[model samples]
Target: MEFTQPVDSNLFDDAKVVGKPMQRIDGPLKVTGTAPYAYERNDAAPDALYGYPLGAAIGHGRITRMDAEAARSAPGVRAVVTTLEIDPLEKGINNVARLFGGAEVQHYHQAIAVVVADTFEQARAASALIEVDYEEGTPADLDLDAAFERVQGTGEPDTLVGDVEAAFRDAPHVIDQMYHTPAESHTMMEPHASTVDWSDGEEMTVWTSNQMINVNLKSIAATFGIDRERIRVESPYVGGGFGSKLWLRADAVLAALGSRAAGVPVKLALPRPMVMNNTTHRSATVQRIRLAAREDGHLTGIWHEAAAYCLPGGRGENPTAQTPIFYAGETRRVKNHVVDMPLPETADMRAPGEASGLMALEIAMDEMAEALDMDPVQFRIINDTQVDPANPDIPFSDRHFVECLERGAEAFGWSKRNTTPGEQRDGDWLIGHGVAGAYRGALVLPSGARAILDGGKLIIETDMTDIGTGSYTILAQTAAETMGMDVADVEMRLANSAFPASSGSGGQFGAPSSASGVYAACMALRDKIAGNLGIEEASFNGGRVTGGGTDMALSEINEEVSAEDAIQWGDFQKDYAMGTFGAHFVEVGVHAYTGETRVRRMLAVCDAGRIINPVTARSQVIGGMVMGVGAALSEDMALDRGRGFFANHDMANYEVAVHADIPEQEVIFLDTLDGVATPLKAKGVGELGLCGVAAAIANGLYNATGIRVRDYPLTMDKFIDRLPAV
Candidate 1:
């Protein structure tokens, strides 16, 4: 089913199940601990052996020698496989660093070997017996400041409109500043894990925790030089994957190889430290933003230049992606630069580019407002653009940025904020308020699904993963609404390579695309039911089909019915610039003597089109808000410059937000629909909630202390001495 034209009217208009705040269908299983994760699938692979991986010590080096004889002869050891014994595996299309089976180490903690044994402790104990020698190479660039000067432009040097330099020179007001954000770890609850079972060297099945099952299948097949159909991947439950599980990691690869070598099923779970140093992370960025505006607060020119580290044959973060679309400007330019580095490969983390990019851009917006002597919310409202600023010829499909800001301001009590910094003192604390706008492009990918009707129950099947993002509930709502049945009658089966291919879960595209696919399949099933009953017109209601003065229970007519279809996109993107918009409002209190900052309260208003399940959507948004808080105040992966490795690799040293760190949070979603987006008319809301949150906190800190910290995490040490003496 091609989604080439806008849906004039669909079953979703009078949706009975979709728009409600339905509880997650998988909640019971998760709470009861009945759902089996990758490493806990003991029922399927009861005789599975345990595999322990050994990572390299050097960041960049060639393996000089490897001796695994001791490990092979250790107690309870069944097999030992080292990188030196196997040919280098082909890199997956979506992977940056090679997973395993390589002599040349790309970064520190790169896996070098795996030891399989009868028990996990035995495998772990035996793995330490393997010895390795390495010859280190010249150290790579480790300084972000030095790398920024020599970084080369990625793709187009810059996105240009009218004369940006001239506009900036002639403008009456200008605010120019540079900002820095350090590398961040995903730190999801579940570590990278997988269990692989090979069948007589002909086929293999892997139960793994991954975001995209079909992509994992292709990657595994490519790595082993086997037919794609010879492998199967299944992941019904994932603890969390902020984007860390989107690709094939070393755990899956090592488990597959170990199972093959030992002639038994093997399971591997990456240790916490290995999960940090061996896997991908969000790259650090240095961004320079220059905003030129008039005295009346209208933006004249916007220029954003960003440079970030990138591994060889890898794409760096584009910190200027949102600059050309967020606000209106006559002349604008966006430049992205990449510097080659020998750090662990960097990839997506939640919102990715927008999350880090907006942290700088939105704070710059606040600074510009201060220069104009205007209210920050009013400044953003004045510059709201309904069309793409870089290309005015294309208009946005649906944008309510001004609405978001206005609503958020009203809800957060913007009028009560103290305009003067350090003036609203309560004992030893100073209070202030801040606001930042959010924007992230709405993306869609072709997805397919199969719907089956059997025994008075509707079943939806797809390879889409939940990833702790509520995919199961939303897809069930889609099927129930289309088929005129209760949500309880719908059974959702997902995250299996044997099922139909779906969009998978990344970049906030999972919900809408996969739901649309389910809608298409349901529509096909409706057509088939109508044709089977020999009725020209039919309506499905109360689990019965009625047409031509004849009515019958759906289950009575047929023992089983099934249909499969895919929602294919056309030229909608070329005609419409579709994106999500939101506003973040925050209140902060700063200690006058110690310069300590704490977020007092937070509120987010979003305009991302129709929300399928408000309960799950709110959970996603609030979770993003907490992550943003962490990014603004705590999360940082400190780099060891001398050795080129992340020094704080464990959870103890890497601080994240706990219950005590977060105060009150509220999330509101505007009731909207985008016809150009999809039949579901719902854009992504998860990443949009995070886009401007960090900036709002930073802006709030500035409002309370009258000091601007360009670097991220906004730690007290950065401004402690500058604060007033006790």
Candidate 2:
């Protein structure tokens, strides 16, 4: 099904199941602790041996000697495989650092060996016996400031548009500042885990916790130098994945090798510390933003220069791509650069670029508003652009940014906020209110699905993953609404490579793309049913078909009907600018003596097209809001510059947002639909809920305290000394 034309008056226009606040159908299993996660999948590979991985001690070095004889001779030990025993494996195209079978250590915690034993405890205890010797290399480039200067001096900017220099020079008002955000770990509930069974000769099955099934299968085949058809990956349930499990990790590869060597199935789960340095993280960034505007807060030129440290041949954080698409400006300059560093691989996390970039850009918007004596929300509304600012010929498919801001401001009582900083006090605390705008581009991918109708029950199969985002519920809704049946009659089977390929769950495209594919498949099945009943045109209702005054039950003539189809996109994506927009309002109270900030209230207004299921959509936005609070106040992967690794690797030291830290949170979704987005007229809100949340909190803190801290994770030490006198 080619999606080239805008859909008019489809079944979704009067949807019965979709767009409703339906409780997640998988909720009972999750709450009852019966959901089978990757590591707990005993049904997939029974009697699987436990495999424990050994990481390198040095940051950057070559392994000269590895003695695993002790570990091999330990109790219940099945086999021991070390990197020194085998030639280097093929580097996967999706992996920046090699997963296994490598001598040269690129970063700290690079997997060096795997110890397989009959029991997990035995495997873990035996893995500690392995000894390794390494020769260290030169120190890594861990300083972002030094790297930024080097790039500024040597390399050309990544993007340059209209004459920003002239616009800045002739502007009536200007604001320039540099902001820093430290690296952040995903810290999802689920660890990177996998179970591999190779008992069937030359054929392997891996049950892993990964976001993308097709991509993971390909990576596994490429890493082990096996045919792609020889491997099958299944992850029916994932505890959580904030873009950390988008690709294959060392756990899967190590488990496969261990199972092959031991002649039995093997399961491996990375320890918490290993999960930090061995896997991908959100790279720290140094961003310099210069905003020039007229006296009335009309933006003249926008300059955004961003740099982040990354490994050689790796793409780091792209925090400046949204500058041109976000606001209206005649002259704009956006530059992004990466400095080569011997650091752990840094990749996507949640919203990725926009999540990190808006932590600075939206705060800069607040500062510019202060300089012009204009309201922050009003300033954003004034700069809203319906078309692409860089290329004005293309208009947005559907944008409700101004409405989002207006409604959010009204709900949050923006008029009641004190315009002057440090002027509102509640008892011994200073009360302040803040707001920030949100933006995330809408994206789609070709996705396929298979629909099966057996005895009146509809079954939908796809490789789409839930990732704790309620993909199963919404997909069921789509099928039920399309077939004119209750949602309870629809069954969703997902997260298996054997199923039809889907867009997978990442980059906020999973819901829209996968749902559209299911819709296409359901439509095909409808055609088949109508044609079988000898009806020229059919009105499907109440599980029955009627046309030409003849009515018949749909299940009566069903001879095991099945249909498979995919939703392929056309050039309409390039013809219009598509994105999701939202607004965040935050209220905070700062202690007068300790400068401790506490969130008092929070509200988010989003306009991301039609909501699939409001219950699950609200949950996703609330989770993102909690993560944003952590990013603003506590989340930081402290880097050990001398050792080239994250110092606070454990959860004890690396603090996240808890229930006590969060206050009241409210989310409102504006009813809307995008004709160019999909047949469902829906977009993704998983990442849009988080885009500008941190900036709103930061701005609220600045309003509570006169001191402005340019750095992130606004700790008390950054502003304690400058607290207002009682």
TM-score, every prediction: 0.98, 0.99
Q: In candidate 2, how many Å is residue 549 off?
A: 4.0
Q: Write the per-residue lDDT of candidate 1 for residues 1-726, one digit (tens) a residue.
A: 998887777778788888899899899999999989999999889999999999989989899899999999999999999998887899986788988886999899899999999999999999999889999979776888877766534456578989999999999999989999889999998999999998366789999999988888999999889998888899999999999999999999999989999999999999988898898899999998999999899999998988888678787687888988889999998888877788888988888899999999999999999999999999999999888888888999999999999899889899889898656777898887888999888998889999999988999999999988999999999998888888888999999999999999989999989999999999999888888888778898888889988798876765688999999998866788999999999999989988878899999999989999999999999999999999999999999988878989989999988898899999989969988899988887878878899999999988888888889999999988777554
Q: Model 2 clash pairs?
A: none
Instruction: Write one digit per residue (lDDT tens) for candidate 2, span 437-544.
Output: 899989999899999988888999999999999999999999999988888788999999999999999999999999999999999988888787777898878787
Error of 2 at 386 (Å): 0.4
Off by over 4 Å in 1: 152-156
Candidate 1, number of clashes: 0
Could you tell me the C-alpha RMSD of candidate 2 in Å? 1.1
